[model samples]
Target chain A: MIERIESFRRRRPRLLEERVTLAHGAGGKASAALVDAVFVEAFRNPLLEPLCDGAVIDLPGGERLVISTDSFVVQPRTFPGGSIGQLAVHGTANDLAVSGAVPQWISAAFVLEEGFPIAELKQIAADMAAAAAETGVQIVTGDTKVVPKGAADGVFVTTTGVGVIPAGRDLSARSVRPGDKVLLSGSMGDHGMAVMLARGDLAIEADIRSDTASVSPLVESLLAAAPSTRWLRDATRGGVGTVCNELAQACGLGVLLDEEKLPVRPMVAGACELLGIDPLYVANEGKIVAVVAAEETEAAIAALRSHPLGADAAEVGEILEEPAQTVVVRTGFGGTRIVDMLVGDPLPRIC
Target chain B: MIERIESFRRRRPRLLEERVTLAHGAGGKASAALVDAVFVEAFRNPLLEPLCDGAVIDLPGGERLVISTDSFVVQPRTFPGGSIGQLAVHGTANDLAVSGAVPQWISAAFVLEEGFPIAELKQIAADMAAAAAETGVQIVTGDTKVVPKGAADGVFVTTTGVGVIPAGRDLSARSVRPGDKVLLSGSMGDHGMAVMLARGDLAIEADIRSDTASVSPLVESLLAAAPSTRWLRDATRGGVGTVCNELAQACGLGVLLDEEKLPVRPMVAGACELLGIDPLYVANEGKIVAVVAAEETEAAIAALRSHPLGADAAEVGEILEEPAQTVVVRTGFGGTRIVDMLVGDPLPRIC
Candidate 1:
């Protein structure tokens, strides 16, 4: 059903629900529908048409810059490995980094609920500052707003980042070819499982921490080694499966993955299996899915493995020409099945 | 006390509250204390030291860019003159404009409640699009996150804008001199009073609508006519009185205001008097406070009056050399009193 860009823009979104649900923000089919129908249709412009993780703009002075924004509303505020503040910084910076830009400056906006403790707010701010410092970006400007008690959760942080794209470096999903190989930075489902366990609702438990981190170092190393990489995307809310599906749809190609080759930590796999969830659909904050030229696979994997964040990097998939706009997975039992975008929110507020 | 920039940085914020209150977000003394103690102290850097509405960055290629962010949490998403969506766009864009930049791009982040109606969201998006188009800015990148029903009120939008600042132009509150004149673009207290009445909590009502609008045209006209303008700021939270107080503190000079010349709509004045609130401390969305060289006062006022939004533009005050960092108002009865930053929020979620 996915074809040329013009046809996609001309297609009207068909939403059946009158009220928004959690599914609409789960970074899956429902989320795409909401964004395309409500936002893309209203703010349709050439710059925003691609719906990439970030928007790339050509300045009047012949320079290119990338801008990305994300809001952190993760439950619990402080997760196992990261707080909303750190996620607020890393999440937006990763968008710019994966877009082949050097993230530089960030703007933070906070929505605080009245009666929230000042001590906790201090810890969050310190975490944000440390994250920004580690990511090599500055929080240059910000705003704060407070609502009455119960109007909002403890606190919500929204960060926007801007970075300059190096000349002659263009990364896009539309460049994926049949022979392009898919590489994942590391294990999946850790972030989602960790957050779920942190919520303390599920009785089943194992030691799993959210991989909330900046993937800039990994991205820089991969780009340096595999200059012919076609595209890169940080596997966030919907994880590797959703990202592959989006790539297939964008390029009118197919993605074929080997389940055995996919990287998943033992604890995360066990938690997902017990919960009846698919590891491929669970979120990972520090992982990236990259498409590279077939010949560059070895070099890319080696470069990724050199970084601590990508120690378990693996080549798990490849592009196909037969089944356009689809993702297929080869089961370890010598069977194959088509994987689709998540229909409902199996795990909400994973990020 | 504000003799040198370094001294301000060395002076630590003294906050007595153990928990954040509504005053911490009211753009007043408590808010300043919180920002200085928590954010400024944690993220101390040269770019963020001034605490300007926006941060100005010099790109590697020598081009100057201004970035600003603001979050909208108005209790009633839909108000008289505009909705939260429009305010999200206009508010951030005005910050860039007052910083002498042409707002070009905006990134919007929405924190939504689970059960918000899709129809309302569509309307809000439409309003945002219209406002961006009218303000000559584009909503280039965006994100949406949904929380469970009670986790958030309805919808909160955080917008960050990037703009280009023309060369040979610099605006800072520290440039004010003893004889510099203060000019206000239009009437005050309309926005806060209108929002207060919109809540239906008060029995007294008037025909006062919010003066929410884009002040880019007015700012441009004033700057073009009077190139010697020292600084400019939009009177948003805490109103014109608070803005003047900030200027006084920043420049280490006293502000002397002529109350008789301060423009106020009859309905707004009546509402403020009935509610025992000072019109000077109430918020205004479209008004601008400008400090200009004494010799160019007439030109500045004339330019401001030329715009429809500035029809009530008036020269209401002047900078003083005595009683440094203080703001004193000469009442119509030949008496004077100190005008301080708002102590607490009289109108919460007024946008």
Candidate 2:
């Protein structure tokens, strides 16, 4: 069986490169291809078939379990508004939350550089604890490993979260249909810009803070009000453009986004313009993209708006039947243009 | 309530060092201090109180879940008998297995350095898949992050596993008694020596292979034969000595080991002798130290020896009532000496 699986995997598309590039981790086409050719092809299973934000496991007693893991290697360990520790917790928790699960237990593993500051490590743990507490989750288990001084940056944290999905709350892109409403939880580009400014390599300054936060509360509210929501996703590494492109491809439908309806803060928009980057491609740590039934759009938006994290929520797009497996953006100037996943991220290691 | 927990945690011990040292991750006294002051104090919760290899969580419907996370940062990505990927899978699975749980699913998160070899990454994924398949477990989900070449080592894989405990089975240090017998599953020092030789830093070489295979089958067999087993632990990072010391401390009992009965292969013994290191302090990736009731020792040893992974199983020690919270070895030369956890590992990054 192992030999058969290996042979089957080898017949798939090859990565065709000696070394991995930044593009392979950009959460775009190259990233998808790498994962497909390497991991998914080798470890194929029914639970991973959907390629959703998290894998849902059916228990013996009619309960559903959701599990997700994420590794954070963000440069400049500490940035405006949050640190890597907090991001590690929120990232995994958000994955579970968007999958319609109530985030519960999390396990953290840390790889630290030999000479990393002990004070900073403590601060990171404190940040993680605070975030987990606020989200009503527990950091149940953890492991720590230290490497030689030059072997690692400062610290990298990997967090795995487990949650229980409420009965009758299945969410997946396969459930999306034409005319479904696409909603944005809040503004974009804050996290990317904040990390860039923190790096101080661009000689540009901005007073933007990362929107790194837990979106579980907002998700609970939205699910309670709009139980028929088709799907939900967090726009983290690849931002909104990549998310919409993935959804379009996964659902085998077209997504028509309106640029005028995009919730972009003025400062974030100005920063992206200055950096020669598209706001749509910048990461947002504390945002969600939801597809709801057209009739339930009002309830979804209203429920999201009641939360502090979703105060700026807006209906930014709609699913379409034409131009299958693609994302098209309607510009403020009344022209439509295709928005493909960026070949590579403009700001690497932003999250 | 959250504020109260945070405030209470703040009054615990502090990590008073300016920078982290190798000792902080050595799985010794310093490591314990670091974990207590930083992580345990911050993330205190009922599920983590045992501080065992894995955390056991009770579900709403009387089902028990075991979860564990570990990050592999071995210097040589591929050692003689296993690669980091295999170790990542087996390490996490063994944690769940030893906790008397049926290993079910795992999630892997990887942080790869930009420019790392794609072939190596593919090989790692293949190894992980094979290990998971052999263990009857699934790699349900994963995340990948890439850091700039200089910011990270070649690659680091963190695996988190989840499993369900079978009914009528309970294992913990608290279940250990003064009359319990300690058994070593197989030979020691193979993994640590193999990794050291693979590094090629030392002038000596040996034909030692790492014992980095899954022990879940062996564990299940033992449980079937001796349902009264008190505790099971894998002697991984800090080896059997550290595990015995921890068990002794946790159970408030003393352990007395017969040095002549330790199951160490001749090659590993010779290598350790040449390197001036004790086999007891060397890591073993696939070996386990099980404590069972005195009456069940025969059944436990018989069951372990029947398994391929535990062909060299031996009863090496016994728990004692006197000299609590310590380990003493009865040397072959007719004397006894205390065997405490090392101040720091002689071989760092051995996994």
Per-residue C-alpha lDDT of model 2 across residues A205-233, encoded as one tens digit per residue? 77899999999999999999998999898
Best by DockQ: 1
Task: Give the lDDT of residue B87 in candidate 1.
Answer: 90
True contacts kept of each: 0.72, 0.68
Question: Please, what is the whole-model Cα lDDT of each candidate in the order they appear?
Answer: 0.86, 0.85
Interface RMSD of 1: 3.5
- Candidate 1, after superposition: displacement of residue B149 in Å? 1.2
lDDT of 2 at B199: 95
Error of 1 at B228 (Å): 1.3
Q: What TM-score goes with each of the models?
A: 0.96, 0.95
Give lDDT: candidate 2, residue B197.
Answer: 91
